[model samples]
Target: MSRLTITLDDQLHRALKETAARQRRSIGSIIEESLRLRGIRTYDSAMEIVSKARAAAGLEPDEALELAVREVRQLRREKKT
Candidate 1:
């Protein structure tokens, strides 16, 4: 495995140390897990992106479902032509 040398702010560094201690894991393992999770950004999948968009539009669960169903039905109608 490759070694990484990075710096962290005082608060973030202290939090990392505390988390490692609480979890009974090494700092390296804590950092690896944090990096892995950080790399998985918002909207990693198509459905996630769609969910985010729906939230931004202030659509409730039922409204969002209706919108999706309508779009699917429209697509099917177009496909039948």
Candidate 2:
């Protein structure tokens, strides 16, 4: 496994610690789960779903990312209507 070093602000750090204590889990596990569910898919495992879609649509990764951004903007506009 790989280790990541991130700098969290004091309040966020404290919150993570508290969550870990409450759930009886390591801080790393909590962070991992949060990253997985946060909807902003930057991690490889998260991106794989988009990657598969791009392949099915015959799009390159960069093209897929741009298209995804446009779709999100369109959705936001529709929501505001």
Cα displacement (Å) at residue 20, model 1? 0.2
Best by TM-score: 2
**Residue-wise C-alpha lDDT for candidate 2, range 1-81, written one tens digit per residue:** 899999999999999999899999999998887654444455675477667769888998988877766765676566556
**Steric clash pairs (candidate 2):** none
Q: Return the TM-score for each candidate structure.
A: 0.43, 0.51
- Screening candidate 1 with a backbone cut-off below 3 angstroms (N, C-alpha, C), the clashing residue pairs are none
- Scored by lDDT, the top model is 2
> What root-mean-square deviation over C-alphas does model 2 reach?
5.3
The lDDT per prediction is 0.71, 0.77
The clash tally of candidate 1 reads 0
